[model samples]
Target: MSLEKLPPLLALVCLAVPGTALAVKPGGTLYIKAKNTHLKASSSPTADTLVVLQPGKEVTYDSREGKTPWYKVTVPVDKKGPVQGFVYQANLSVSPPSLEVTSKSPDKPLSPEAFASSGAAVKALGPGAIAYGKTLSRPDSVQQLIALESLAASIDTAQVAEYARAGGLPEVVGRPQVARRSPAKKKGGK
Candidate 1:
């Protein structure tokens, strides 16, 4: 290839190479999506927590590319200057999160402890999500969802490990497996 052609070819090759370039430029801003999340020293979840990032806080994007689950970022701490750390990508968003607090019935506000005790946060589906499910033309979608959730709940850690092994899932082979508590058995059903 000629010298002039090599330059264009190299550029194409670089672009074609996956995970080589940063998704966002270094120093570009990214907002924290979660209410609170830890900025870790490394990409892993078990890494040391460098700082706690709050919702809507802006952090400078450090070098990271492609489908990596973690984003390397520089967060500004009050006592400590700009601290470089890694945050899980799921905890971040490109746009700032809305800080507005909304309630269906403000006149009768629910207590935080009561809400926690209700277990609604984890189990209940929002009306909006249910409506979206309805729109997909499955009238019994809610029932199906509940059934699926029940099925998932019944699966123990051993079952999951066995399934992963039987399916030849290499990714889960060495990863720490979290054991789940067995669901409450029905009375006289054993």
Candidate 2:
């Protein structure tokens, strides 16, 4: 078609801007449901820890770009810039976590342990909690505790291997490196 016959929008679209444009926008919100989740530098668990996210933190999800079960999340450390990192999708929930703290009514008089908050649960089942757990004779509670422990251990091992493979971190951190001996020093620092 002749230039004059072209629609105004079409004419503008024909301009040779000589550049490419890409759009990036947050897709959805994901909540961290498990304690001690790491926001890794990449899509693997072994990636450097960009941030250690506590349970109940909300993050913006952009994409599920990798083969591994990881999500791209944006977290802000400061006003300077947002940190883009990957987190295992297993511990993530599509809905924001609703952690019940306690009864809103003071007159209700809740028990000391009535309302088990997420933070409390995290601390309660922490590494040191095993001793306390062993002392309990409650069958149901014991089973649940065992389940949680197994889940946590499996997740930890899988993440570590993923991070080691993708993040370029050594499987074992802080290993000693043998010093490389320099060939016989030529007379006085040749």
What are the models' TM-scores?
0.41, 0.43
| Per-residue accuracy of model 1 over 24-120 as CA lDDT, tens digit each | 5677888876533667677765566666656678899887745778888988877747878788777777777653322554455444333434454
Write one digit per residue (lDDT tens) for candidate 2, span 101-163: 443644554322333432334433554566666677863675687787777756554465457
Q: What is the TM-score of candidate 2? A: 0.43
Tell me the lDDT of model 2 at 142. Answer: 58
Query: What is the number of residue pairs that collide in model 2?
Result: 1
> Candidate 1 — worst ten consecutive residues by lDDT sum?
173-182
lDDT of 1: 0.64
